[model samples]
Target: MKTNLVANCHKAITNYIHHTPVLSSSLINDIVGAELFFKCENFQRAGSYKIRGATNAILNLSEEQKSKGVVTHSSGNFAQALSLAAKSIGIRAYIVMPTSAPQVKMEAVKQYEGDIILCEPTLEAREKTAQDIVDKTGATFIHPSNNTNVIIGQGTAAFELLNKHANLDAIFCPVGGGGLIAGTCLAVNSHQNGCLVYGAEPFEADDAYRSLISGKIETNDTTNTIADGLKTQLGDKNFPIIKEHVSSIIRVTEEDIIEAMQLVWERMKIIIEPSSAVTVAATIKSKLLVKGKKVGIVISGGNVDLAKLPF
Candidate 1:
């Protein structure tokens, strides 16, 4: 919730990121029973807000630091973002991703010209493989959420959202590793807009919710939910930021997530991943409420493989 971090992130990532659009849908507002604004990061470059964080992390690097290239581990979106960003700046990118990452994401990373290292589908394995890659290649390790620059960079979304919709009373974002919510907390609550920032997590893997209630960071004993994108444990850095500035974490289920994904695709005409659908699901499931007040929900990514989607 540092003001300086938000300011620095704004300054650092301004040239690199999009001021992703915020649109109000009477259709969504009617369905959700709230006056709603959608911060459509699903429409963002790299298909996600991950680009904001990834680009910030890469562009902040010193010439000497970037000389060895950059390495990161992701379920999908971050890998694609880093791949695209690194390629743009003429830096090499090595991405360690779970084998279970959506085929679409894996293909996108390869399409963006990243060197992909596949590991078993778990954060632990992904981290280990990423470390091994870094050790051998001398590439700098860029954590998806734990990195400060990355967190700050991710906050730029809220900065843009608030600039566009200053009156929003609340904002809901999907929580994976907690980077997006952490940055949002800093940008929205810790700063001038003072919106109530809530995080949505899969009930199947509701680490952030438990961590918030328990007053400590918690990892799910076993990951679940179709939101394969939200499986990472909340970060140490992000936990503190959420505890400080975020209002609450809302939990939803795989059923809820799939329903939400279908809603977005069918009604909103956006192809959202289940992870991104968490926010919409939380809003609809009455796990959280916005009522007559203005509400903002971030669509985190749209990289779901339709062939893999559950109808």
Candidate 2:
């Protein structure tokens, strides 16, 4: 993807999306021995950066496509994101969520007026269900992470971050379906300052890390990580960008994720989901990599079940 794609996307969605703040904590900075800038997308619309891409994708759709509406299979942030984005534009949103998804997540989509189709808790089921909706209703299928407009939208978060802190030595983000990190890679390329992009993933669900090493897409043997959002593997659309531009993928243990989440909550007094915490955990785990540098961490989301928090 070109840098202009991300730059233009940020400009296009500026009015529609929140310009989330970059927060810092001196205590946490001291612990990591680096000046850490947290791009707090946890405070973003739909409670995650997913809304930026979701909004961009829908806004770019043709009038005919908008008339038929849109459909996607996501049980997490993207479901709510597409629902809210489509709702904002007065279009119908069909969200296919897995039966095993948390009831709270399903309720959140319903709150946004998304018509939910229940399917078995498998990627195959989710894809087939979403396709069935597209076949029946002619709704455009917007992939959560692989769509080009969506990647450009996701890049806007880091684009805004780099615009505000162009001097950052490197930026780290949690990797899942790879949209955000791939977008981040594109955003970093726009700056002449040579800011590098890194992805933080859980050891339990480290397909991204393994994929980088194997030089092809890799799947997780088990989706057993506490960072539920990072369980998905990379896609053809984003994986190429990741392979070319991302500096590396850092793997952190489950204990590291929990400790990092607790640290952010206690020190920064912010509620970050485990996926967001992976970036911080990676920074802490690889302290020497960022020592004495100005580093940016993308806090991806804050939507967590309060009753089942890891801590």
Candidate 3:
């Protein structure tokens, strides 16, 4: 829970994870009326920021734990991240992916040499399958966004961002299970004063926003947004940190999400998934809030299915 834990994680996985570039867009700044710094985690290994946490989690495991292997249930980025990290570290990875997960992501996991366990497309089924794997193989289960090590690992992205741009007035990130934003909160608090942290969430799956208001975790009745990565509900581990440190959760529409994704692709010439665009969409939606300020937008990942693009 200490901010210094992020520093430890960075040191542990420095050789393994990429210190992703922080790029700016003059046009985006003009549009949002703020100087925007985009932390391009899309270019990160495994094409997402999840690798930071995945690598740190694996590296922190004891030799015996490493021998037994690590497991996680993720349909997209984290599945690939854990697989690649484990492969790089010479440990086995057990990935429990829902059958409805994109074929491209599943293939990427396989490409990383993950042992895939396909299950029904339900949270219950995924968790049960992962637990079964742990029971049978004694593999350690790493929750994608809820584990302490994972959260500390994720904070390294913001830590890097702040290391390069220490004077940022604010930082924004997309919220799903709350790991990224929660870690970001610790990063901003540890590194700078008066720098706020905000979370962008899809209106279709605004559990984080509602959870903030309700002072408890909330679930979605249906996740019908293009931002598949932001559909998951907040977890107890990350929700407390988010509720304590995040300034607010801005909900953006599906159309806005697509527009933002298209803008980054066309203007920045960078490929980003719908989840990554939520921060941009929210920034644009709340232009006045960030006007005349220096803001950092954590582009969560770029693991989009090109063949199934919304734009």
Candidate 4:
């Protein structure tokens, strides 16, 4: 995976990905008790780091394949990403989203002029609908998390992080479908073996944590997390890489997420959704106890609906 990923798609995903800066913050660093280097991927185009994977997946396709168009199932961000990329390339895109996905995200897909299909919130239903669309249209399916190309493209985030700060002691990212963390672990393990990789999840959606501990895939019963973007089961492609390189999993509460969101908005002046805030939440509440570590955290996305906030 490393050889195939690093050697091949890294260059392909460059300019399209923001390479969002890693800034040192006294507020975050002081509160967390570490030199907190925040990789502000919240600044990524398409409101997330997903643009890299979407671009990579599209570019890897043959002209005939692209001519046939692309389709995928996503909770939201990937849908918006692929929609934007597909529009840019003059290719058709179909995005199947769960009915429960954030309305704002669905609107973004529509704004990109994507054909949106709503499915029941279950993974099986979403995938089935996506496959049906693919079969009906001859469009290639781009798995949101499981594909080698997508994972490698995601790895570029951690790759950019390390390129900026080589001597970091650890990297933290919120986990969901595991594309971001799995790719991040691969990049960090190959480039910074000394740095620990941590996956942060809301307690309500802590499937990755349980899955890692039990040495098998696990699902959470309480899928009622506000972190809507971190709401998918782990995929086969992401599982082995996680089991291999992930240092540990940390769980944060809903309160922690809210506080973290407030922290970014008040101190960092950044608007992050609940899912992206999980990295900040776990960093401050769960893993901040790791004193003296130089920790780098990827703020995955910043596409929050601020008008809904009571603030």
lDDT by residue (1-311, candidate 1, tens digit) is 37777777788777766777776768878777788788888888888999888888898899987999999988668888999889888899999987787777788999989999889976679889998988898899999888887888888888787877888888888988989999898888545765798889988899888988899888888886788778878878788888887787788878888888888788877787788888998887653367677888888878767566699
The alpha-carbon lDDT assigned to residue 135 of candidate 3 equals 99
Model 4 poorest ten-residue lDDT run: 1-10
TM-score result, candidate 1: 0.93
TM-score of each: 0.93, 0.98, 0.98, 0.94
Against the true structure, candidate 4 has what lDDT? 0.85
| Candidate 3 structure quality by residue, lDDT tens digits, 1-311 | 47678877888999998889999999989899999999999999999999998998888899999999999999989999999999999999999998898889899999999999999998899999999999999999999999888888899999999989999999999998888998898788788567999999999999999999999999999999989899898898999999899989899998999999999899999999899999899999989899999999999898877778786
Please give the RMSD to the true structure for each candidate, in Å. 1.9, 0.9, 0.9, 1.8
Of candidates 3 and 2, the better by lDDT: 2
Could you tell me the TM-score of candidate 2?
Answer: 0.98
Note the Cα lDDT for every prediction shown: 0.83, 0.93, 0.92, 0.85
Clashes of each: 0, 0, 0, 0
lDDT-best of 1 and 4: 4
Stretches of candidate 2 above 4 Å error?
A: none
Could you tell me the TM-score of candidate 3? Answer: 0.98
Per-residue lDDT tens digits for candidate 2, residues 133-244, read: 9999999999999998898899999999999998999999999999999989888887658888999999999999999999999998888889999999899999999999
Say which prediction, candidate 2 or candidate 4, comes out ahead on lDDT: 2
